[model samples]
Target: MMIHGFHSSRQDFSFGPWKLTVAKMHVMKSANVEKLADELHMPSLLEMMFGDNVLRIQHVSGFGIEFNATYALKCVNNYPGVLKVACAGEWEESRTMGEHYKEIIRPYDWTYTTDYKGTLLGKALKLKVVPMTDHIDTEKLKAREQIKFFEEVLLFEDELHDHGVLSLTVKIRVMPSSFFLLLRFFLRIDGVLIRMNDTRLYHEADKTYMLIWAIQGLR
Candidate 1:
C-alpha cells in the first residue's frame, strides 16, 4: 500500500493482529535564529552551541499494540566529518500469556557487531552527499523505498513476544558518511509480519530532512 500525498491528514490500515492509525502530519523549517540574535549582542554558551538549517516532520500515530522506534544523532567529538546514529525501542502485548512467550526475545546485547562493507548491497547502503548530485528526487526515492532499504541492507533485530506469541522486531541503518539514518518497527504474530512504522532522516549541506510512514491494519 502506497500513500500519494504528503498533505494527507489521516490514514488507517491493518494486517493480522496489528492495527495502525496516523494523524496530524505537518512539516517544519528552522534556521539559526537564536545564533543570529546572539551575534548582534553578547553571546552565551547555549546560543553559541546552536547550529543552523533544520527541517523536521511531526506526526501522531496510534498502534493497537504498544510500539516505539527512536534514533539519536551525535557528532563525533567536535568534528563534523563523522556522526553516530543509535536506535532503540520496545513492544508489549495487551495481556501476558505464558513463560514461553515472555522469554521469546531478549534485550539487545551490544557486544556483537556485523560488518556489511564487502558485499554489493553493503556498498550501496552507504549514502554520501555528492557535490552536484540531484539527491532530492521524491519520485525515485519514495518513503517506502527508504524504509525498505534498511530491511534489505542492515541486519539488526532485537525482539520480544507476548502471550499470543506476538513478536516485535526493530531494525536500524546508519550511512557510512553519516548522511542518512533509517528505523523500522515490525510486529509478527501468527507467522506474519506487519510493518508498524518507517522513519528516515537525512542531513544535507543546507538542511535536515525527515520522512515517516506509520501503518496499521484491522480484521
Candidate 2:
C-alpha cells in the first residue's frame, strides 16, 4: 500500500533480492527548526530558504547493497562554503545593517550549491568511481512498458529572497523488467546565473549491477 501528501507517506516494493522504499514527508516543524538552524551557520541563507523539507528513497538488496536517495534541506544547502560567482548581494533589498550584514554572508554560498550524490546506508560498500564505459539504456526507457510504480517529490525549494528560484526534486519508476530514477537540483538567478546537478540510476531485472550516472554544470 502507498500514501501521499502527509508527513509520513511511504511506499515499498520487493522483487527478487531487492527491496525499495520511498518516503515522502513535509518540512521540519518548530521542534526541529532549532536543529536545522544549528547546522546552518549563515543567517542570511537560512532566512531565505530555512532548509526544513525532507524526502528520501531507500534501496536494499539481500546481496549487501544498501543505498539511500535522499533529498534533505540541510544536506543540499551545505556546499561551496562560499559563492564562486559573487552573487551574494541578491538578498540585500530594502534592508540596512550597519556592520553585521555582510559579515554573516561573507563566507557563505547563498546559491545553495551541493555535490551530494546520495547516502550509503550502514553495512553498505563504499562506491568506486571507475571510468564510465557504459551508459543508461535510453532505448529501454522509450519502450512502452507497464510501469508498476512511479513517484516524484520535491525535496526542498527557496525563492532566494526574490532574486530567483532554487529547488531540488527526485523521481523513481519501477517497470516490469527494470527500475529507473532521476534526481535533480535546479537553480535560476533570473538573469545572473543558472546551474543544475543531476543523478540517474537504472537497474535491469537480469543484471547484477545497477548503473548510476551523475552530471553537474554551472553557467
Candidate 3:
C-alpha cells in the first residue's frame, strides 16, 4: 500500500536559541502539482508528489537548516548519473505516466533516492563545515535526562509505486543539558538494497558552536 501524506496537529517548538517549525499539510492536489511543475520545470514530477511537507530548524543568531520535498526531488534529478535502480512494472505511477514521462525519467533515478544533506540557511551565522574529526557526544544523548520538547516531522515520502519506501524526515529533542536533532533520508528497495543518509546536530546550552556530523551507508 501507499500513502499520499499525513497531518501533524502540533505547533512549532522553541528551545534556547533554536526555533523549529514542522509543516505537514495534505498531499498535493492537481493545482499544487501544476504550480510545482511550472516552478521546478521538471517533467519527472509527473509521477507522484507531496508538496506541503516541510521542516525548518533555525537559530536566533546561529546556523540553521530546512527540509522540504521540492529541493529533495530536485536533488534526485541532479544526482550526477543514472542509478542502478528500477521498479519495472511494479510502479503503478510510472506505468500510468506513459512513454513520454518515462523518457524524461530514464536519465534519472526513478527510485527517488536523494543525497540532499539539508538546505542550510543563515549567512551571518558562524557555522563551518569542517571534517568530521570530532563527534556528537553519544553518551550524553543516551543519558536519561528530562526532555523538554520533542517532535518528528516527515518532510516527504513515497512507496516507490509499491516497490519500497523512500522518505526524508527530521526530528528534534530538547533536554535541560543540551538538545539533539536528527535529519535522515532513508530508502528501501525490498530485496535490492537499503541506503541511509543521516545528518546529526547537537548543541550545548553553554556553547556557541554546534556539532554536526553526516554519515552515509548502503547495503
**Best candidate, TM-score:** 3
Positional deviation of residue 141's Cα in model 3 after best superposition, in angstroms: 0.8
lDDT of 3 by residue, 95-214 (tens): 446776666643345556667777788877645666656679899898999998887777667777777888878888889988888888888887888889887888898986678887
> Which digits, one per residue and each the tens of the lDDT, describe model 2 over residues 71-106?
234454444444444344546432325566545533
Candidate 1 local lDDT, residue 117: 16
Q: Give the lowest summed-lDDT range of ten residues in model 2.
A: 62-71
lDDT of each: 0.26, 0.61, 0.71
Clash pairs for candidate 2: none
TM-score of each: 0.24, 0.74, 0.80
Q: List the residue pairs that clash in candidate 3.
A: none
Model 3 TM-score? Answer: 0.80
After superposing candidate 2, which stretches have Cα over 4 Å from the reference?
A: 1-7, 44-87, 90-106, 124-132
Candidate 1 structure, TM-score to reference: 0.24
What C-alpha lDDT, on a 0 to 100 scale, does residue 69 get in candidate 1? 11
Ranking by TM-score: 3, 2, 1
